[model samples]
Target chain A: MARVVVDVMLKPEILDPQGQAVQRALPRLGFEGVSDVRQGKRFELEVDGPVDDAALARIHELAESFLANTVIENFTVKVEEEKAEAGE
Target chain B: MARVVVDVMLKPEILDPQGQAVQRALPRLGFEGVSDVRQGKRFELEVDGPVDDAALARIHELAESFLANTVIENFTVKVEEEKAEAGE
Candidate 1:
């Protein structure tokens, strides 16, 4: 099996209310050292087979179509070779 | 100014409730190829000065102190050299 990591975030020009809320809450949350907080999304996937470019393309399409709100958020997809440790 | 990106994610064994919700909604959202979705967090920051390791360490502490629930999630912070375009 392989692993894929997808990240979703708002375009630079987009205002993120969720991120804004988190940013505003930081200081009140007893974290005075913080200035801003921007919220985004991460997705982890374990595929049944090898992670190839085609699989990545499909994932990108899936993200664009449903996983992300293109009106504000854009996505980045990455695939990794999953290594399994023996001796459980 | 410089930019910093932070990513927060659940440990491999941790259950991601928000990700699960999005995963369930995928098929209904007209995405048939999606199998599962796990949600995490991304943050982008523009600093007043150069990007440095000390600044990153402070950001890490901030994230741990308030931005993320360490009980379930871990954070990775990256500093990128943001370039400026002249003649704008």
Candidate 2:
């Protein structure tokens, strides 16, 4: 099986409150030197067979239409050679 | 500035409801061929100056302590060569 990874991120122009909260929490926890932070989503998909171009295209369609919010967010798709092993 | 990405994912043994929801929703939308899905979190951090080993270590500490919950999740950290550009 092939492993497909989709990374969904907020548009740069958009403000990310979750990221901001993490940034704020960092300093309070004595972790400094961070300039900014942005939070996003990651999806790992396991497909039943080799990941050919057609499969990639379908995955892209899924990412665009179902996985990500295109209006204020952006996403990227990558296909891995092997399935992600259980327990890392 | 340097860009650091922390990818946080649920442990394989742990069940992912969000991912299951997406998998179930896919076929309904006419998108098929997906076998399974797992959802996770991504964090983009902008740090001031170069990302040397020291910075990476600090980022790791932050990731371990705050960015992810170690009990049920796993995380990986990568230092990007350049900052991600705005808007694609």
DockQ of 1: 0.29
- Candidate 2's C-alpha runs over 4 A off are A82-88, B83-88
Q: In terms of TM-score, which candidate is strongest?
A: 2
Clashing residue pairs in all predictions, respectively, total 0, 0
Q: Which ten residues in a row have the lowest lDDT in candidate 1 chain B?
A: B79-88
How would you class the docking of model 2? medium
* Residue A47, model 2: Cα distance from true site in angstroms: 1.2
Query: A1-88, model 1: which lDDT tens digit per residue?
Result: 6667777777768878887887677666654444545677778766556567776777777777766788777777777575332111
Tell me the chain A TM-score of model 2: 0.90
**Candidates 1 onward: DockQ, in order:** 0.29, 0.58
Question: Across residues B1-88, which tens digit of lDDT does each residue of candidate 2 receive?
Answer: 8788999999889999999999988889998788899999999999988889888888888898898898999888887866543323
Maximum-lDDT candidate: 2
Q: In model 2, what lDDT does residue B64 have?
A: 88
Residue pairs that clash (backbone atoms under 3 angstroms), model 2: none
